[model samples]
Target: MKQLLVPALLALLAGCATTPPTPLAPTGPKIDTTYTAKGQSSRARFLVLHYTVSDNPSSIKILTEQQVSAHYLVTNGPQPVIYRLVDENRAAYHAGVSSWKNYTQLNSSSIGIEIVNPGWTSTPEGGRLFYPFPQEQMDVLLPLLKDIVQRHGIAPENVLGHSDIAPLRKQDPGPLFPWQRLAQEGLVLWPDANRVANVRPIFEATLPDLFWFQRKLATHGFAIQQTGMLDQQTRTVLSAFQMKYRPSDFAGNPDAETAALLEVLTTPANAPLPVVPTPVTTAPVPPLPPATPPVPVVPETAPAPAAPLPVPTPVPPAPMPAPVAVPTPATPPVPAPAVVPATPAAVNTP
Candidate 1:
């Protein structure tokens, strides 16, 4: 009994030694808390939007079980529901490998919204089809977005799409997503349409080159390398911007119009700010693609260059035989004129 008792006491003491420490319990002045009004603010300062390529059930399974999650998952179906997965206070793994403006690893300082939709379909023919978010889903989204942004005091500039943050790896909430609609709701910033129109003609006349576009894009908070080359990364950044502003066309090709839009967005340059539309009614915007997927198109190929013009064959010049020069008698070499040696002049002794 003595042996057992000693061993137990020794084990207990060792366990206690290895255990982690907890906050000390207050004894005297239980709290030294200050009741001051001034204090720190929330960690979140940005909001990132994304679309799950899978349906609601699949998205939930992937987000939860796959160790990747979002603060909220919005659904569009028989009954639209906004499901809160991770608490807003905690970080979610939704914005992976992302950066926008002054933030990086955005999961640290951003609230991520994942809406359920078939993001994009790549047909066998190598063409991509991006689907638009349903009206029902967006109706639920507006209030939620407004609340999040307002509560965090997030800037309009900080609201970004996942692709806007990770252009090379993501293209979510694709072109069909009505960013302009969000802008009207005061959730995101939009370029003044009138400003774009004013600058477009100027740009077309003396188009700003690649460097100008890159600089403006970087200033607009895109994390792009200023390589001044038409590289893939540059194209991806252009595509992301087009998706946000000019959903009508996002072929990823840089043009005078694109440059003009960037210029307008970055610097209005004496242009008046557009008033936010109170009752958002978009015109000329196509209603989301019909339920039936459009016919798959074969990837575009370069047309064969116009057949080369025929070159006229040149005739070879007639070969001339070496002329046999008649041996002209060698004329006597002309005698060189003799140079007379002049006498050196005597130095004058003054």
Candidate 2:
């Protein structure tokens, strides 16, 4: 009995000495939101572009948090992967106090795309600068933007940067972003130098009323009002405009070139839709007056005025013999004021 007890106790002690296995942590991709239903409007009119200032994990945290989120997040790694953080149908809390053209509160009407980038960094010249986006990153973005634009019937001009919409505070998808390539893809508007130059002569010859320029910018999806003065708001709008159309030289001044470029962009293009004529409800035509009966009536001729009425009442002609000569007055010569040699005020004795 003692031997059996010793063997059982030894077995229990050995089991206790062995360490327990550790459970595996949860693995695989994390999804913050899901699309339960298809979007009501398949046509996405606006594309609000942004740059992810944080790394992947940090970005995920920011987007997953209730306070902020985006529809898609494009990572900047070598392989460049895109994560759909929020369902496209739902409004992502990305755009804030924004306006574009007629669109206000763009969060309700636009798709937010966050591109992973460090944004502005310091250059050797001691100026804040941006890094070039990797080609691989753009490789993923181009197709995605194409898909979204195509599916939603988004206008080329509607695809815009975050700064474009919220210029006063945000500057994302900065100058280094490949907008020219995007324009090449038919995703946005590009100004032609020739067209801009053609209008340059006009702009330079005549000083453009600043208010008119402001109105033009506001008309083109920029958030600005015609204040008749070039204020900070106007500068912000110009800065946003420069970021998109005049990226090479964005000085935020409404110079001749910028004004001319704006005019070109706002001009109407060649597509015209057929106008349907309104259905004419012709009032029943009244029966035409039954062929007018022609009555032949002889006209009564009046007697000619009694031959040559007497040529009486001839008034006598007045005499014009008095020619009075008026005398011309001589002009007085004004004398120059006497030059006064004013004495200097007496100096006070110190």
Candidate 3:
């Protein structure tokens, strides 16, 4: 009995030893080298904004290296300079576990730009701990964003933040991010205030049936399913939407304002077209004539007939009489030609 007990214990120990270990969670930065070879050409679109919730560039740079690195980093200072940390072509280790419309894993298709600022929340005690973005930083960001958006052929709506794509987890470029200015520059999408006001009542009445709102958000490239009920996922998606469209107040509730804003955003007429500024000519240039130049008029002239050439007379040949057939002796019948058997041609050997 003692020996059997020992063997049983040993068997239990062996079983425990052979059990599989738990898999490690995905940690640290996601360094994707798939696009490194091609650079910007490898990237398909531009995801144009972010905020490094760090006080300074050095801290942000260190954090980015230790955690994740964006394609570009703009410093927060009086005279901000844009730093190209990673090539635009490579997939920067930003945008973790994200989806937008048909696209999933946006890092594969986007170039992320991080703005250095200490993005923080105010305490109930009313302490001003949150560091605001410097004007100079935004000034630098706008032109850079424009260049990237134009070069990559990224649509105005596609220029979204890390929070917009991964709303459940992130909110880097928060409400303070200059979305209005970017919209004015035609870099991002902005809801028309008047259009949103008009659509407010419709969204409010249909708030109970969230499916309608979810469908519209999905149509506008947000990754949301029309589940009818306002679930946790729906709330998260709505929070993301609020962060982008209604940043001033982002409580994640399906309020009239949020719905109205969404309605305006989804409408084509409300969407701003890409402004093409006419090139300003410094030197005074002469204006060109009309597209269809005027035809020169010609005076009418009377037509005159010239003298006709003399017609030649027809020549007549002398008429000849038909000869009569001479009668001749009957010739003997010709004999049939003898038939000969043709010889077969000899075959030639190669």
Best candidate according to TM-score: 1
In candidate 2, which residue ranges exceed 4 Å CA deviation? 1-43, 122-127, 270-350
Quantify all predictions' global Cα lDDT against the true fold: 0.86, 0.83, 0.77
Error of 1 at 349 (Å): 44
Q: Which stretches of candidate 3 lie above 4 Å from their native place?
A: 1-42, 125-130, 204-208, 270-350
Better of 1 and 3 by lDDT: 1
Model 1 stretches astray by more than 4 angstroms: 1-39, 268-350
TM-score of each: 0.67, 0.63, 0.60
| Leading candidate by lDDT | 1
**Residue 1 miss distance in model 1 (angstroms):** 45
lDDT of 2 by residue, 1-350 (tens): 99999999999999988968678887998877766666665635799899978777788888887688899999888898889988888889899999887778999889999988888878898877777789999999999999999888888888899998889888888887899999999998777666666666777767588888888888777878789888988987787788777778776898887887887787654432223245799999899888988998989899888887688898999987898999999999999999999899998998
Clashes of each: 0, 2, 2
C-alpha RMSD for every candidate = 28.9, 26.2, 24.8
Residue pairs in candidate 3 whose N, alpha carbon or C atoms collide under 3 angstroms? 39-89, 40-89
Give lDDT tens digits, candidate 1, residues 213-308.
Answer: 888888898899888888999999999999898878887888988987887778745655333235666678767866997789999999989989
> Candidate 3 lDDT, tens digit per residue, 155-250?
888888877787778877877777788888887878877676666766555563688778977987777777888798789888778867777667
